[model samples]
Target chain A: MLDSEVPQEGNSTLAGHKKAVYARGGDGKMHLVQSAGWEVEEIVTRQAVDDLLRMTEDARRRVEAGQTSALEYHMHRVRMDIPLLAQASGIWQWRIRRHFRPAVFARLSPRLLGRYAEAMGLTVDQLQKTE
Target chain B: MMAFQHSQASHCESGVMASMLRHHGLPLSEPMTFGLASALSFAYLPIVKINGLPLVGYRMPPKFIIKGLQKPLGLKMRFETFRQPAAGVARLNELLDAGQVVGLQTSVFWLPYLPADLRFHFNAHNVLAFGRDRASGDYLLSDPVAETPVSCAPADLQRARFAKGVLAPKGLLYYPVGKPQTPDWQKVLPAAIKKTTRIMLDAPLPIIGVRGIRRLAKAIERLDAKNDAARTKLFIGQVVRMQEEIGTGGGGFRFIYASFLQEAAELLARPALNELAEQLIDIGDEWREFALLTARQIRDRDPLAPAALADKLRLIAEREHGFFHALRRAA
Candidate 1:
């Protein structure tokens, strides 16, 4: 998980592995790297609502040593897997339903339409049928 | 005991009454759902009456499958009494040793909150516990979540991985083969039906409060007396809600129906109430048989979709409802 706190320059220098680095900013937009070992800066934190994308070397070491949950270490990977699994299950459930109910598409039309509208943060009635 | 008054009851109505007898009643009455389940299960496979009646799918997951076919013809499925944490691993080992226990569904058994130190990744569901590797000593299992079959060693299978719950041996839950063309099927059906009916009638109390039926009956009576059509409709909704709670949304329909009967304990006074009770009972009976047949068919076909089975039941319930309404007027 990314922490919001700005990285200390002294700490980055002490790690001894300084190299020009680039990162995606908190705004989900990419940023340019100017100097060696670019740490999460105050400007990034101010621009993004979410915490700055920074996992200090010390925290990384602790997690690698099995001191903390991989839940934090593999947060991004886990988050990516969840939506994929849900989508797969939904497709499978739909296929199975279709096998049993030949008209499953029509049968589930109302329910799916309502769900999708809600998901888009819109009401069901707002979905106009565009022939 | 005075014979239930039949001056107004006709032969057709009496037949309907027999088919619709009140299957469920009160807080502790026999669980109608179990009876329904047993009778239905008995339809497809000759269910060996281990306990009084057979109970299918009414219980929760990681359903235990015991070893060795006890009867030559009948199928026996059991539920283990207690649970242990290392159950998934242990059960996998036992089924491998048995050789006959194929097509298993694996799932995680733990709570949401877990300790940091004791973390293991083994919360898998619908995994088929099939073959095991001899040289590597790895268990060949089907991981439904992955939608593929795989092999995993004991270490790879962790106890703390899934939710936190002890997975112990329940009972042997295997479908037994019954005599293919036995004349005794007729004899067995009634025995299994009666036994299952009694068993279900005996098992529900906790979820459906003791006084649930009484309250429903009161509400129904008030609505009917006031001649308030809308309120009566609302009362029907309340009954449906109560049914859902007691039946676990039809999971425990028999028990819920029984509770309804209990609430209408004084139904002897009103012909209509008495008739409605009977109709519900018959519906439960048919549902039990239908559900079992569906479960059996699905079980026979590997990786059967339960949705298909549920659809079959919806059709059966719809038909039964028609006969039920016809009897309501006479009662």
Candidate 2:
């Protein structure tokens, strides 16, 4: 149940407005309800997103420093772990692990690269780039 | 394309279903659609991990709402999935050209219009595509989670539809093949309520329903005993995500279920149903409180301890167990 009074304006990451939620009304009917923004829930959601973004950033830094391949970085950016990435690309886990190395990833064929790219929802060129 | 009204809903799948039904001349509220589908449930599968965290689902798996509605209402539905992106887009455009509003299962992370913080790899987000803007080549999207209809570039929409991961959308598209006749509430409402109640109270597996809640509480206690702060935080955070973020209507779908009960009470002219609705609302408040406390613990950087948190969860489980038990008998 939501607060009986209309919620006051508060900061939100949503599209610059409050969203309606259904709540139990006095008449025992469900009514369109509003909130002052779920600040606590928003904070938790942002923290999770920040944790993900940090991982992607770390991956990007590694790729830029030539410590890892762009495929590895893009995998983090798309929020897929190694095993999950392996499954999605339909490549064996050991083979996918090997591709994380810059030299190994660079020597991969275009057809193989295309599979990785398609799995990541990117083009072969985009997959190769650090961004 | 047909002119379809876009209304905001607390959850995506139900909202999309409601909007799609309304477009086909069968108007249904989000809660009503959700309730009729008997979509509510609880599961805590430690073995099923998403992003390396255990899965905690407050409802049945994806497409259950659509499938659930199909059987009871006798709706003829056409479901399509594509192996190629181009074919999927072509098929979607064909449906739009025929003025049919289509329901799409898409990855939330791939939809660029959503706030970045809210974007995750949840692949079962539902939206309706009614038309396309010829000038800009954008698809008119009625994303139920959003406040208003938005347009998505064709490329972005394609990525969302074809995103690969667990529960991949695979460009799944569905539409009702014909108009749905209004259902007989007298016959359907009680049965739907009873079925949902039975599942919640009587599911045999310990990993699901009331037993599942107890199982989660025990797991939380075990996690606390391990004293791994980071792991505990991650586990609790996933629970919050499943409860609040993943279209559970702010309290693990408890409020939505209550809303359904209220509506059912009116339609069936049963005061007892109304009383049950109130009880469900109270249970929903308890769930909300638990979420808030857990959030506070995380935000305040308090050390993870099983005693306090587990106690809270146990109370919730106990209350829900009793409530659902009574609800099952009453229904």
Candidate 3:
């Protein structure tokens, strides 16, 4: 990686930000060069992010279609799965899976809802109702 | 808090480790810290899933450098993880107030100061939380991957420190405690080089070292056989994201290791090390080429492009195998 070869293609994964990268300078030493971004990096980042967004959108549709509950949508929206949500909230995976059912989720106590909300970095109200 | 310099680095854990050690009066470059820790390696783990995608890491898992340096450098450090979040926060503040710079393992997603595009659920991101901002009273962080030192609100910092999942940080904070005993450079450098060669070439696991790259290459070809364009695209995207998107200093830390080798070449006056460094830079370029080809394959939707991509990786793997073998002999 030469300093001259530092990718400044401007379509980096970091959006507009630049970060330190080591590149060979004219002095034949490694210099900390800030990069504008790379197209290859941008595409991969967008792919991963878009996949998550797609999952969230798919969850939204499933919830609307009554195939799953709002809990499923919110979980994907917050970038978590069953095991992650369980670990974060200290709820069992089985119990969380059970709560994915609309009827069980509807009857949840406020305290339990608060735990899920806190684990996902959402307010309890936000957890209950989706926009 | 103000005692340490905030320097941006291509990678986080090694960068933060270097910063902390430098603040403690040990002068080590980020690349040097990384190489000494033997932190560079490739692992394509299918069993560990992130959002239904296999875990593809450019280097070893996080905190390897921070923990790896302790024994080799004769450094004594205090590491603490709290079951309670408040205790964790309190301990961090106490360390800061004691005029110590602390290294933290945090989740990238909860750190609000980062650009929205860079935030994800990946835990084990490392940063140095030095002290508080004068005006805003936020936790002043020297995030190695960020160009400038940034400030995080207390709430955000707390959330980040304790963010939960696989590799959940659990409010882990660490800092140097006692003065370090320096080791003999002649012995340490060569030993580090040998350890790296062994890891890259001798690790017995099928999913590690040179074998790991080959495993991933074969998996990519197998994935292409499914002829599911979306699935293949996502899997390849995961590889690119791990290699290029994550702060790998380009080519998944290959360039960084090259820099380290270059420095080692000069420090030890080992011309063979210099030769190896050049060889590595070429491999790093090959890795960049791999990324470029994969991107084009995604765009063209050419069915066989992925197998071609896999072929590129296998070539790189064989080159690496040879490189490490030569390195072992050089040491």
Candidate 4:
């Protein structure tokens, strides 16, 4: 959990780190603080502080760029998250086949890799090696 | 008080159960009541039957082929394929607009292929035309992948797709028209003789060695360094791979696939797999079974939760390395 009251220190929604952010108040529980737009980190983490921090970074980056809305920034974050997602999906595929052997690998097609990549926030390049 | 472990034992037990249920064309949704009965009867015996000359190596379609098709059935007589989640959904919408039924084939890709240390594909496949809300255009789907008929709407569809691209919805648009009818028993078996072994005859069986492992490992390490979302991403990767491995072809693959699907369905029902995994560990086995079965309560409103997915994937990955090591030793 992150502490929002720690102060933004003038980090507008348009600058600095652009991950997601989540916060927890003095009540000892977590809460979402300033969920401006969908940041890469926000979509990944459930904690409010994490979401807040990520969102703050995203907002600050967009704000500095003089962008109109957070949605555009979020879409951009979506692109960056793709490779990570793909890698994650790869890990998941590994778990599914934990008990099997090359037969599964032989059975897996390229299309499945692409879908798996999308789910895990990865790109085809990451999911499938080029060379 | 006791804790339920998602250990290898649970996975194995679940795998064996899945194989038997599938063999009987039974839905894995059977409760512990039946499971306990079977256990007491010691009726869970393995039956091996010899067939024609064993077909050679495994065969898969090209990535282009898998990704090119709008749905899994779209790959009729073709090798495996995949598509971008949004694009896959868009294609699904297109197929549904055309009025067709679909079939989804999902799997865990990694467990079986760990020896090669290469990338694997694992995910669920949902086939059926989209049933949409005429007003909001929210779509609906029916997946023939499970023991029982499974259906979901657009929002849920997107969530599942988001959770892992493993879920492939191949349109068998003509289901309403005429899909050759098979016997009831045939439909229930895991290795549906006709369908499971229908790989292209001329397809090459290449042994994928450790060509990609170094790179995959590096990428995982980088993701781990970020340490924020990497674990989640990596976890999902492992799970997806595991699914693909099971969905592929292996002696024990069907059982493995069944266990994960049961777990995935269970997770899909609860807030998420990790949450349930964490809570189940302290709740003991009986309560855990209830918790697992409660996963069937997945509602249309709940979207596929990726964060929770990542959490579950992480748990799966933590224990997965051992299995991979075992595979390596066997190989």
Question: For this target, which candidate reaches the highest DockQ against the unseen true structure?
Answer: 3
For model 4, the stretches where C-alpha displacement exceeds 4 angstroms are: A1-56, A59-74, A77-131, B1-100, B103-127, B130-138, B142-178, B181-331
| Off by more than 4 A, model 2 | A5-17, A61-66, A123-126, A129-131, B224-227
Off by over 4 Å in 3: B224-226, B301-304
Model 4, range B1-331, lDDT digits (tens) per residue?
Answer: 1111110111222222223233323334222111211210000001210010111111222122123221211223222234555665666566556654333333222222121112123233323333566786654332222222224445445544444332332311122222222223212221221122222111122111121222223333334323344343433233222222212211112222222323333333532322322322222222122212212212113332343333333343333323333322321
Q: Rate residue B313 of model 1 by lDDT.
A: 46
User: Which DockQ values do the candidates obtain, in the order shown?
Assistant: 0.01, 0.55, 0.71, 0.03
The residue-by-residue lDDT of candidate 3 on B1-331, one tens digit each, is: 3466888899998889888888888878999999988888888899999878899887877888887888888887788999999999989988888888888999999998887777888888999988898788799899999888999999999999999888988899988878765667788889988988888888888898999999999999888536588998888888988888857899889999999998888888898898898898889999999998888776665553678988999999999999999999998
- The candidates' interface RMSDs, in order, read 29.8, 2.0, 1.4, 19.1
Clashes of each: 51, 0, 0, 124
Q: After TM-score superposition, what is the CA distance of residue A110 in candidate 3 from its true location, in Å?
A: 0.8
Question: Per-residue lDDT for B65-124 in model 1, tens only?
Answer: 112112211334332322443664566567567663333322222211222111112222
- What TM-score, to 2 decimals, does candidate 1 have? 0.27
- Kindly give the stretch of ten consecutive residues in candidate 3 chain B with the minimal lDDT sum: B297-306
TM-score of each: 0.27, 0.93, 0.96, 0.28
Q: Write the per-residue lDDT of candidate 2 for residues B68-168, one digit (tens) a residue.
A: 89866779888999999899999999999988899999998889888776777788999999899999989999988777899999989998998777888
Residue B303, candidate 3: Cα error in Å is: 4.6
Worst 10 residues of 2 chain B by lDDT: B299-308
Q: Which ten residues in a row have the lowest lDDT in candidate 3 chain A?
A: A11-20
Q: Distance from true position, residue B214, model 4, in Å? A: 7.6
